[model samples]
Target: MIIKEYRIILPISMEEYPIAHSYTTTAVIRQDLALGDDIEISKSEPVTNIRLPDGKRTSGHFVHKVYHLRRQVPKWAKVLAPKELLVLHEKTWNAFPYSRTEFSNPEFLKEKLSLRLDSICAPDRGTSENIHCLTPAELAQREIIYLDIAGEQIPRKEYKAECDPKIYRSTRTGRGPLVGDWQHSVSPVMCCYKLMTMDFKWLGLQDKVEKYAYEAERKVFCQFYRQMFCWIDQWYGLTQADVRAMEEDTCRQSCSRANRPQGLFGSKSAVLLPARAARLVPESKSLSLPLDPSTGF
Candidate 1:
């Protein structure tokens, strides 16, 4: 016979959860949250203890204390200048599915969200006018506060982190150019195989793809791409000479940047002017345009 002892985990309030407050856009992430709020869980300390077979009490938290879930805000998202944490008091608020917004337009929300027949959001749907009209059962539902910037939903990809900063990454070598990675040429635009194909689909031809013979050389496909741009320029009343002049100027600018003196960044290539930073990407190994539009090389 053996006696077993188990230590139970006490659930902490949302306020006590380390990540709970990080989501807040307020000046102090945790100031609004009180220590004694209605809680799903609570703990006096962040850790729970378990006794080992040798009777040693080892303590550990749910996550490594050193690793915080909500890390630094992405540089791009931060540049968007998000303001206000919009809280939805009621679930019935119509219009966008987002329950909360980081950017506040309170008056617009108040005026727009309504149950009135003529209200812009309601659309004559027979739903209760106010949240108070709902029963306790109905009131019990999932509440989510989503981040919104200015007037648009933050990109879905932004919410999900693609790279882990904590993990050290070694430089990759001798690999074939993957589908979406940039082309080999150094230029004023970091034109990738993916971006070009997408640009081809969205910008130049709404539904048409460039036609070529089965034995067509790589230059043929690239020329088709350039010709489409030239055609677009012609449509916009630009002559071939104007196109040539513009191409020369752009090429000169690109070459000047490529040969410019190296700066504090150590590598000459790394030191790009403000305008040039968006231009050149590190050269890819591939020399040819992807033949397959569906799966770029």
Candidate 2:
């Protein structure tokens, strides 16, 4: 059966010295008709009803939810130890609702699968001293990188230019590209605008739209950033070795029980085997003991 939508209600407490409240988030996945029969409409889960203490004890209320997804992996998950896998799994599962769980269509599963494969094949960002820093203009000139659910790089840009100026501006400030505040630049607004123009033109972003594009871009990027953070927490928290060991242990236990060899042997097999051999030797001890006593007398 096709899953039209999936919802998960999570309860969290904001209580302590500061005060807190409870809330829930919802995520949606749908089939997109426009992108052919293959496109999937997916939305990330949103969080709500967060309570903070002021002087008022606010009762519970439902908050709005927004969906977000990012197609990139951070640089941290590659170095954690094997024991961290459980944490990774737990975090990833929890963060799934907040991530890009929807596909253009089920066919996008190939893309998704590619992402997973990329995570496996991509080299870990281990302790390399080669620090590459680029200005917004420089970064915009390079390729666009797409990441997967596991926060691994799945796609690389060839010679394709930027797709959207708004996206470029947002990327420079948001988590995807430049990250952090661009306001500190020589001419924050102008610098950002120029960077956006360059990157967007390169990526094919149209400049025809005006107004709150920057703000809109910011919001979109923030959503993406949140997803990336969730992924980072998920990935850094787990390792692959632990999963393998657990699976191996489970397989061994299953095989042993299915064969029932241990039960067939019984617990007394060691003692019984020796006793049976002694009996087969014929009890010469009795005759020997009696003969010795008679000779002594």
Candidate 3:
């Protein structure tokens, strides 16, 4: 069966299913991964062809990553806890989807797994000075950076240019390079283009930049359905009992609808009885009327 792929996303659908609908082909790639759909991943073949805002077409690559998430969240992950008492597994991309370790002692998991939740959420927007325990809202805004399939490294020249020491000192605002999902599905590529551009300056983009930037920051985000750390996918929270119930429901609903053979129509047949030479009957002392007209009393 063929699933329709659209070059441009429809506006009507975005308004209807904003959470689920995505224009980024990577979203489809994520879906394929999440559902465990049959797909052949090769380092040679790009995941999907993406059309840049300037009509330049490029292909993206998939970076396979794995994380061992706890089947059950730690009891205190919900409550307020000390920074030293918690541990996060961190994500392959250091972005939206991630898992953490569950331990009464935070340092224990780190020492055992050599893992810890990233200290900074974003370079520009770091966590509180005292604590780095990221909230679900904070995690949603994180980005999963993907390298280009062709191995074409896009550079941030604006931040990297050499400044004239004699004239002035250049000050950098962002803590480091751009991170996270820059052009993932359901996202508009125009923003990524703007971020990755050279010294080109344009007006009428402040509102748009702010708007797209916030959209890029996923609040209350989950990719459990599409990847290792799906936050809100129905299957993410499914238990053994839930699986059994689903299997039983599926069996009950399944039925064959094949057509049955029609019954043949035929004419009615006549019935005949053998004629008797003599009637053998015992006469009753009490006279009784014959019930049938053909029978003689």
Candidate 4:
């Protein structure tokens, strides 16, 4: 069997409303199966979108969609099978929202404004036009927060960054330039990929070796979860225990934090607790053994 991994970075500007509390988006990962002269695509169910209340109407939208295809090899093809299969092609694409919005009546806004005025002084009227836009530099400062794949380190050139081409399109429309020859170039985004090899004999399905091979591949891909957890710990200089504790605390504190209005002063007591704990814990300080030379597909 042959396996290839790909990492893709989705452009954030593609989202119609990139709000702070909006659902987190991720780039899609795809795998294709190829054997000899045949190839098949794999499919998975799409993720359900989160529903939000909008006055009297309820709205929801999906963030990601996946598709798969498969083919069965003819019995005669087995006679000329290669000793090992080769993965010839792989690709990834960005996913983004086509549209998004949330609406409420003037009464709702007036009520909130009144409450604010009673507590303090009169507050500025906030409008939909007041939405915040993240500059490229600001976006870069934020962490990727998630990745699937493993390696000590992967070069940045292997991945492409998701960028907003809409800005360029808008500029072209306004200028109406009659260019002789103009070149357009975009920056690349960094991404990482990890690969794992696991023993399949433990599953006790040797009689159905072909089916077992497919199952094994799925398991190996899912093991990318473990790899991501390890990567996050190392990147943040946090111990495994500290990471777990931070996740637990983050969930518990989210509700309270959400209740507070955006940009209001707040204590960093919750945020600093994990950082201090992580610093106190020592690193594992161990080296991993090299892959076994006898291992093969």
Candidate 5:
């Protein structure tokens, strides 16, 4: 298994991040739908009773989203990869200030592959020691990376001037235009310490796929938080009820676009087709891994 810890510092406070996160995620879902990618929210409900590892009780929300990326795959890989392999199942347990998300492929890859993320939001400068309570063995193998939202260089293809932190200033709260040495000067700074563990047990593809997962996680973090800061004007001043109502409206719209029944809160779709083991073997050199969504961050 590959273990990585990504620390991302943002200008928002811990109290206000949940609203911004939900609002931005809803917007991202719509954008994905517009790009011909289908997302099914298999389950979404409120969790009022959650027992933490420290034996403390808390309340939070739960959401399960399955991503369909048939259109995003290369044509050649489609011939070798099965329909089931094209989908990713995500279950997120979000208790603000702390959350855990798991991503898995179909049943066939249950033992061959696995991914889990644990995040802790704090008001410090990424100085927490073992925030996720990782084991000694896990800590020895873990890689820590600090993601500078205002300074990190993303791919040119994914860059947007509107999302650039150096150019965009927030109209609400006035926290924008993060210039040099902003981490020391930014007021009300918080860090999302995210721990990602992934393992792909394929014979020839295990190493490459594990390395790719780290990069994928990093990309998702930088992109999501950059947009989170840039879109502050829209989500800033929103309450919990306000965000929940927006989520409901987005769910209805998603159902309409998917042409499926609405309000299937606890339903799981049996849409993946089973394929033979031989058909699952693809040319490793030409295979590209799908990017997981930014959930529970």
Candidate 6:
């Protein structure tokens, strides 16, 4: 098992993050659809009194997604790998400021592999206590990687001036063009402590595949947040109701669209990972703050 904690500090406030995140997720899902990946939102609803790993209960929204990604795998692998291996099942329990997502494949991988993501959002400057409450073994095995949205290097083909944090500025919030040391000086700064855990046991392929998964995850996180921040003006003033409406519309559209086959080759790094191009293995479970027994969100 490979465990890693990724800390991403953004120049957005805690209050605005939920909206921005929701908007970004919907947009990314749509982009995947446009690329010909079949996305199925089998479940999207509210949940209450959900038990946490720490024995507390919380309430929030839950979502289940299935990605049919045969086209996202290389042609050679398509001939070698089983069709079921190309499909992915995702279950997300989102209680704002804290969310847990699990990813797995059906049948074969359902028991041998596990991928989880636990996200804790805070308004601090990237230094919060051990929010996920890792056990001694987990703590010792985990690696901490900080994602610098503005400073990280990107491939030329993947770079977009519009999404570059060093260039774009939000007109509405006036919070942009994050320069060096922005994580320390930006107003209303927030941090997302994303804990990712992956346990894959195969024929000597575990280590290589796990390493590639982390790299792919880092690429996704950096690019996703860069776009999220750059598109701040669009999601800045959106309310929960507005996001919900947009999601409903997206769900409707997804249901109506035909599930066309596509290719594994794409501009996005998430799809171009040569090792496992079709699967996204980001996941988590948690510990730091007091769980609101009443609301759970």
Error of 3 at 10 (Å): 33
Let me know the TM-score candidate 2 reaches against the reference structure. Answer: 0.17
Q: Largest lDDT belongs to which candidate?
A: 5
Pairs that collide in candidate 3 are: 24-185, 95-143, 140-218, 143-180, 144-181, 223-230, 223-231, 224-230, 224-231
Tens-digit lDDT track of model 1 for 1-297: 111111101111212211211111111112212211111111112233533222345442211001011112234323542432122111111111001101112433343222111011111111223212223443343121111111122345533221111121213212111112212221111111111111112233222322211112122222222222222212233333443344334333433544543221111132111211111111110110100011011
Q: Show the lowest summed lDDT stretch of 10 residues, model 5.
A: 281-290
lDDT of 4 by residue, 1-297 (tens): 212221222111111112200111100110111121221111111223422112122322211111111122334324443323121111111111111211111322222111000000011111121112324553344222122222213336632222112212223123211122211212111222212111223233323543543343333322332222222213233343543343334334432332422211112221111111111110110110000000011
* Per-residue accuracy of model 5 over 72-165 as CA lDDT, tens digit each: 4556547766777877777776666677777888744766778888777889889887887877998999999989998999789978999999
Clashing pairs in 6: 58-296, 59-296, 116-283, 116-284, 117-283, 117-284, 118-284
lDDT of 6 by residue, 161-180 (tens): 99999999888988879998
For model 6, give the 10-residue run with minimal summed lDDT: 288-297
Model 5 TM-score is 0.83
Compose the digit string of candidate 2's lDDT tens values, residues 116-223.
Answer: 000000012211111123345544453322212122222345111232212232322232232233222212111000011111121122232111223322233223
The residue ranges of model 1 lying beyond 4 angstroms of the native Cα positions read 1-235, 260-297
lDDT of 4 at 151: 21
Pairs of residues clashing in candidate 5:
none
TM-score of 1: 0.14
Q: Write the per-residue lDDT of candidate 3 for residues 23-138, one digit (tens) a residue.
A: 11122222222222111101111233433323444443222111122211234432533443333321111111111111112353333322212211112211222223334654
Candidate 2 Cα misplacement greater than 4 A, ranges: 1-195, 198-216, 230-232, 239-297
Candidate 2, residue 117: how far the Cα is off, in Å: 24
**TM-score of every model versus the real structure:** 0.14, 0.17, 0.16, 0.18, 0.83, 0.82
> Between 1 and 2, whose TM-score is larger?
2
**Would you list the rank order by TM-score, best first?**
5, 6, 4, 2, 3, 1
